[model samples]
Target: MLALAAFFSGAALRICDGLLPRLAADFGITAGTAGQVVLTFAIAYGVSQLVFGPLGDRYGKALVVCCALFGCAGAALACAFAGGFDMLLRLRVLWGIAAGGVIPLAIAWIGDAVPYEERQATLARLLLGTLSGMSAGQLGGGLFADSPLGWRGAFGALCAGYVVIAVMLLARLRSMPSAPPAQGGRLAFFPQLAAVAAIPWARLVVGAALLEGVFLIGALAFLPSYLHQRFGIPLSAAGALVALYAVGGLLYAMAAKPIVRRLGERRMVLHGGWIVGAGFAAWAVAPAAWWAGPIALVVGFGTYMFHNTLQTHATQMAPAMRGSGMALFAFCLFLGQAIGVWMAGASFDRFGALPLLLLPAVALPLTGWGFSAALRRRAGAAAA
Candidate 1:
């Protein structure tokens, strides 16, 4: 049920990816300008995490999540009925702020309840919701935006999903036991945020996650646009094809246990990085839009291969302040994503998408190698 709410929120975040071209045409802007919607949302989401994380810790994680989900419902509805591009952007920023709290806090809640040894697999299961949302957002925006329903219809549907999830979550919360708020002075939140930031291991994890968001998500935001221009494909077709990325993610969720058993964390990061790099490089050269689908699949698979590992580590980084810890983790990741998208949009405006895609192709592998090397150093130091 909680995962359902997350699915809607996640969908809302990514839906703009498919709608960018439509938005541009409707508002008489370039595709690059339409991309600002994504950039704005990511920035709002990232900045709001700082507030939501501590609030979740101080109030209750579940309670805060429910409230945020309700906020998302309202914000998404506002987006559906927005009067202009500026109105749409404003609503999306609010939607981003509302949706920001759902996933990280849910992870923190799981961290509070689950044992360390079993947490990775549990996180993988939860990722099913996120991955599914990604698919729905991408595909739904593509499929419905061109139908009689139109782009506004895509958002209206998302609003309905958020409302349903909010109801279920509210009912569940009413039946469950609640924890007392974490006791603190008026200034308590900043200290918890500071404490998590102080840990060397947490810093590394957050940094790596940020890079992941920057390189992977930043490049991906423009893929549908890239396809439409390069192949003259319609927005719906382009988006549906790109939605294959989530198919790859679902594959990872399904096989996470065996993959982890066979590969280990370091190898998972190393191999996953190489695989994603290869996939994007293929995307750069693919002769047809159809080829991009398979490439997106491989990229998605490799993404979770690396990111899920970071997620597991984040949950344990500051157990005493898990909400703040994970929230900081999310803040860095989305902030990186926001910056990445902004830079990529500018690059798309200037040089086109090929160079942008190819850059990440090289960066992801090196990032994996860096993480592996860091892990080895951490292990050696602990042994010493």
Candidate 2:
């Protein structure tokens, strides 16, 4: 049930990626300008992480998640009714702020509930909800936009899903027995966040998360647009094709246990990085639109293979302050995402998508190897 609820927020986050072309056309703006919608939402999402994390830690992660789900439903509904680009953008920011609370906190909630050795497998299973949402968001956004109901229908459906999930989650929250307080109640917000930052391992995890957002997610936001322009494909086709990325993610989720058992976290990240980098590099040079489908699959697979490891580490970063720890992790992530998308937008405007995709191809493997090395060093220090 929690997984089902998390799906809506995940969908809301990526839905706009596939809709950018249609939005640009509707608003009579350039593609780069339309991309600002993504930027604004991500910025708000990043900023709101501070509020939700602390609130979750103080009040209870489940309660906070339930409330945020309600807020996301409202914001998404408002987005459906927005009369102008400015109104839509504002609503999207609200939606980002609301939707931002769901996933990381849920992970924190899981961290609180599950033991560390088992947590990665549990998280991988939970990602089914998230990865499914990613696919639905991209495919559904494009399909709805081109359909008679148009882009508004896509958000309307999302709003309805949010409401349903919010109700279900709320009921569960109310029914479940309350958890004991952490830190004798919540510490003051800034101090809590500062303490999280002061931990070296926490710093490494969060830093890697931030760069992951910048290098990988930032580049992904432009895939549909790139397809539309480069190969003259329709937005819906491109969007549906990009949905293949989720196939890769789902595969990882299913295979996670064996992969982890065989490769260990460090090698999983290192190898996943090379795979993702190869996928993106291939994407940069793909001769036809059809090729992106399979390439996106590989990209998706490699992404989770790498990212899920980071997520697992984050869960254990500050066990006592799990919510705040996870929130800081997400804060760095979406903050990096906001900045990355902005920079990538400028790059897209200047150099086009080739460079945008190509650069990540080289950087992601390095990112993976670096994070792996850090993990090994941290492990060695602890053993010593």
Candidate 3:
């Protein structure tokens, strides 16, 4: 059930990717301008973490997740009914806030329950649900928008999905035992946030996660649009191709356990970064639309390779206050995403998509190397 909620959250985030062209046409705006909706979602998703993190720590994580699921349902329904782009944008903010609580809190709960050695593998399994929803969202948006039901129908479907998952989660909550809140204080997450912010390791993890969002997610949001613009594919076909990224993610998730054991986090993340860079660079130059499909797959696999390592560290950023720690980690990540989308949109308008793809291709590998070096330093410090 929790995984289902995570799936919807992932779906909600990307539902706009394939809808950008339709949205721009509907609202008499440029395709790049329609990205304001995506920006709003990312911003709301990031900021809400500040509130939900504390609530999750004070209340039980499962309880907060359940409540957030209902909130997502309500917001998604509102989005379907929204008459104007402005109204729809506001509803997306609400939906993003609600969606924000599900995944990070789930991660924190896992951190509380599982040993670190096993946590990455477990998270990879959970990632399958999220990635599946992403593919569904990407495809559904284009298909629905092209149908009589349109983009609004997509949100309507999302509302129903959210309600179903919320009900299941409620039942699961009743059947299962929940861990106690890590915190129960009036001051809330501030002190915990401070403690995390004060730690060098925590700062490094957060910084790196933020970069992941900026470089990876920012460019990724534009892939469907790139296909539409460059290859002249139908939106549905573009979405279907873009959805191949999730296939890559699923492939990586299936092999994650063995990969983790063989390469270790440091080496795995380093290669993941380079592989993602190579994928993006290849996508940028591919002469035919068919070639971009496999490139998207490589991007997905590499993304999880790099991101899963960061997520594992995020869960331990503040061992005793993991909800707060993970929340802050998510905040930085999506905040970077918001910034990245805005920048990418502006860049697309001015410079086209080549720089967006190619720049990240270079930066991501360096990011991976930076984190790998940090890990080595920390290991040496521990030995010392």
Candidate 1 lDDT, 54-164, residue by residue in tens: 898898899999999999989988988999999998988999999898999998888888888888888888889988999889988777756777778988998888889
Candidate 3 clashes between residue pairs 3 or more apart in a chain or in different chains: none
Over 228-318, each residue of candidate 3 has an lDDT whose tens digit, in order, gives: 9999988888898888898899898899999999999999889999999999899899999888788888889998999999999999888
lDDT of each: 0.88, 0.88, 0.89
Worst 10 residues of 3 by lDDT: 175-184
TM-scores of the candidates are: 0.97, 0.97, 0.98
Candidate 3 residue spans exceeding 4 A from truth: none
Looking at candidate 2, what is the lDDT of residue 289? Answer: 99
- Over 1-384, each residue of candidate 2 has an lDDT whose tens digit, in order, gives 778976887788789887888888889988888888899999999889988888888888889888899999999899999999999989989999998789998899889888898999999988989999999998887787678777788889999999998888877876654345565444487788889999988999999999999999888899888988899998899999999999899999999999999999999999989999999899889999999999999889999999999999999988888888999999999988887788788888889998889889898999999988987987899899
TM-score-wise, the better of 2 and 3 is 3
lDDT of 2 at 180: 58
**Which residue ranges in model 2 land beyond 4 Å of their true spot?**
183-187
